[model samples]
Target: MSRSKFFLVVLICSFVWAFVPGYLFQSLTSISWVCWVFSKSVTAQQLGSGMKGLGLGAFTLDWTAVSSFLFSPLISPLFATVNVFVGYVLFIYVVMPTAYWGMNLYNAKTFPIFSSHLFASNGSPYKIADIVNQQFRLDTEAYDKLGRINLSIFFAISYGFNFATIAATITHVGFFYGKEIYHRFRASQQEEPDVHTKLMRKYEDIPAWWFYSVTALSMIVSLILCTVLKDQVQLPWWGFLFACAMAFTFTLPVSIISATTNQTPGLNVITEYVMGLIMPGYPIANVCFKVYGYISMSQAISFLADFKLGHYMKIPPKSMFIVQFVGTVVAGTVNLIVGWWLLGSVENICQDQLLPPNSPWTCPNDRVFFDASVIWGLVGPNRIFGSNGNYIALNWFFLFGAAGPVIVYILHRIFPTHKWILLINIPVLTGATALMPPATTVNFNSWLLYGIIFNFFVFRYRKKWWQRYNYILSAGLDAGAAFMGVLLYFTLTMENRTINWWGTGGEHCPLASCPTAKGVDLGPDSVCPVF
Candidate 1:
């Protein structure tokens, strides 16, 4: 985003600022000042906690919290970013609080205001192991005795938004970009090569059959894994094909969004939901299907992004393909090896209940993943989102999602001169909250604040400075924060060292994860009373 003139200054400033929240003042990651003001009140903490609760009017100084899930706002177009802001305000401020407090949707007050954990009918933690038999299927007898699993209102509704996001992405792309894409395709096929195309064609080109052969080989192995190794994978051969088909279908539309907006809609939730609905009681099956369908499409978008960069740089297609292929192989292999080592080496990893407070190995990400498996695979969507599920009506979000783009397209037609009308992107808007479980509300608040400062104000008033240093600032901040993470891992995490001070102690919002329902006992000291 900038030039060499002020590059060093930008880098230094970015590093200096990132260092504050990255290490020294950790609680800056989520400063729910309202909670601090009303420090002893559970209700206040529940309403204001950025990490575990509603995060009402909360803010953060941490760039990691800002950039981790949302990516560099400097890179996103202002229109798309504005749409996200609108969606976030509507969902978080209006819809979420109303669903939880006013309507008491899904008995929301019975559990924490915002959490990812599953719960029993009486507000105890849902014991997944108790309801699972040796075959990894839900033991109907145990489930009946224990009663239906429940989720926090936020988790349940976030899923409904997931369905809406996926549907909206498809319909949005069709309404907005379908015609331009069709015409471009037609023109590319019919017209003679441009000078740049002719020049590019002179370079050594990768043969089409090479791609075909690799694809065919991958398919053969995948099919074999699903069929002959069905006992291991649990997903049937037909399910594997269906997953592939869905990925293929979604690849084009999702890529268009990614290529243009630098934001890609997640297919994991939708894929998992579908597999869970059709092929219930198979957790492994659901996960594999998600990995194939969601990851495959994601990789495709990544490849296209690389190709776009290569084209802009005039890199030969053959060279780009070879480099990408080798990089993929090495990266995949190393990731597996590192993951294997961590799972074996780490003690009581992901076991938050057993782990000491502030344990580095308490994996928030894995907690979300495990919860997904329980919802879509173990318990199945039938008992969660289907006829038997509490969220059956939330399925209407799919229709609401589809209709969103149509309404926008109509407005675009009527107010043709109002160019801003066309920029009301439904997909980007709806997907604004898609990363919430793993990405808390402070993330968005911090992100949006920075976005407005840089993308809007700086771009408008300090155009030249923004054009030169915006992206550079982002890169420097990310790199500095990442280096600090690695350093902390080696210096402190390796020896389980912690600086026990008020500032170092995380956001002081303990009651945020507690259930508010009356008569729910959470051990000896923690119990909810009638309000």
Candidate 2:
């Protein structure tokens, strides 16, 4: 097949896939829910609280599903078939028992609920306390009640839109690359290869199927567990599952890049660009809040895996690993501490008003998949400059931000400059910030700061630093944070008996002076004697 013709077909498919799912499905769902249901004060509160509840309930169940499914599917087809035939059997007999065991283990290792020391626990536990207190507060109880009513409706909207966006991004990228390769071959006067032929010849070395399958299965398990166990569990199971799913999903690119390119800076650049384009409307800080496990560890893993692969191909594993570990630890820790400080302060000070309404930290507002339509609806078509305007601000910023890279590319083309342009990413990012609405200026600035730090320290230091050391450092930091998160989870969620220091004058205690008869012999300590 001729390369040019192939590229043309690929381009066409990319264009269609990108627009169809994102616009038709995600946009539609977001508009309908955000505008009609979520925007209403009563409905919004109900929806918000419900989502929080659902997210918590599903946390554990999803983790079990994700962990088990990944290994199960990777085994033989017989195992996969058994998953279908004995699926219910496994759920009832195997999964349930495991979950029960896990719960018991958790209880034994954790503190009792309602304990004063537990209540006084700060950080994540305090955060959970705040959430619960806020939900049941006299002022917000109405919203809490309403949130329950509209919970399922909003979940469907938000999750559906999220899936739609993922679908669009993947399909668009696939088609775009496919066609680009096809066109290049056609331009060289080669015959157009069939899909199968192209797959075998060009992408056979890419491990594309492995990447796609892992990602798809991870998402499927997450959805199933979230839906089935959302209301059944006391623990925050959904959050756990979400974290695991994100970890695996984020690992896909790292694995691919590791196996293909030996820790190339170009891969990081490509990833950053793709992330910028696809994740624009959402707050970038979410990378820390929701998917920190993936974001921090995956990059380190990519470096390690790539180094290991290179080692197997005759590179020095021990030396490379050390370099990677040190670099990652130094940089990732700084990033985490800095990010926590900045975002935590912002969260405290700004509260709901931070970033525009739909920014990442603002829960109900940041839930873009389900709420986009409503936000856009409120903004309407004409009042694009209004503080609440959605599409206009996003569209303008995206257009300009996207163009910054292109402009850089053009300069490189004309001047044939050296690697100095790499330094321009910082300034270019600053320029992008300038394009955002005044309301979101802080958010953009935060992101710009992160990008600059990431590029300068992490990306650029790869060659100078040892790969293994970096991975170890990143892994250690993540491990520490995860441990703290678990501790906080137990301190906040577990039910415990509370002892009142002051005795009450009742049957359980003793009325007034009657309790003074301590010298009298009681028949049994368990049973108080009648005086």
Q: Which stretches of candidate 2 lie over 4 Å from their true place?
A: 1-370, 376-399, 422-468, 493-531
Error of 1 at 472 (Å): 1.8
RMSD of 2: 25.5
Candidate 1 Cα errors over 4 Å, as ranges: 1-9, 12-19, 192-199, 525-531
lDDT of 1 at 140: 84
Which lDDT tens digits does candidate 2 get at residues 486-529?
44335532332222221210111111111112243323531223
Output the worst ten-in-a-row residue range by lDDT, candidate 1.
1-10
> Tens digits of per-residue lDDT for model 1 on 1-531?
236545556556656776666667788989998788888788888888998877887888777788888887778878778888998898888998799778988888888878888998777788889999898888989988888889899988888888888999988989998998899988987888776777787788889998998789988999999988887799998888899999999999998887777778989998999999888888999999998889998988889889878877789999999999899999999999988999999889887867776566778878888889889998899888888878898899999999999999999899899998987888888888998888888888888888878888999999987877788778877776676677777876688776778887788887787776677777775634434
Residue 35's lDDT within candidate 2 is 20
Best by TM-score: 1
TM-score of each: 0.95, 0.27
Give the TM-score comparing model 2 with the true structure, all chains together. Answer: 0.27
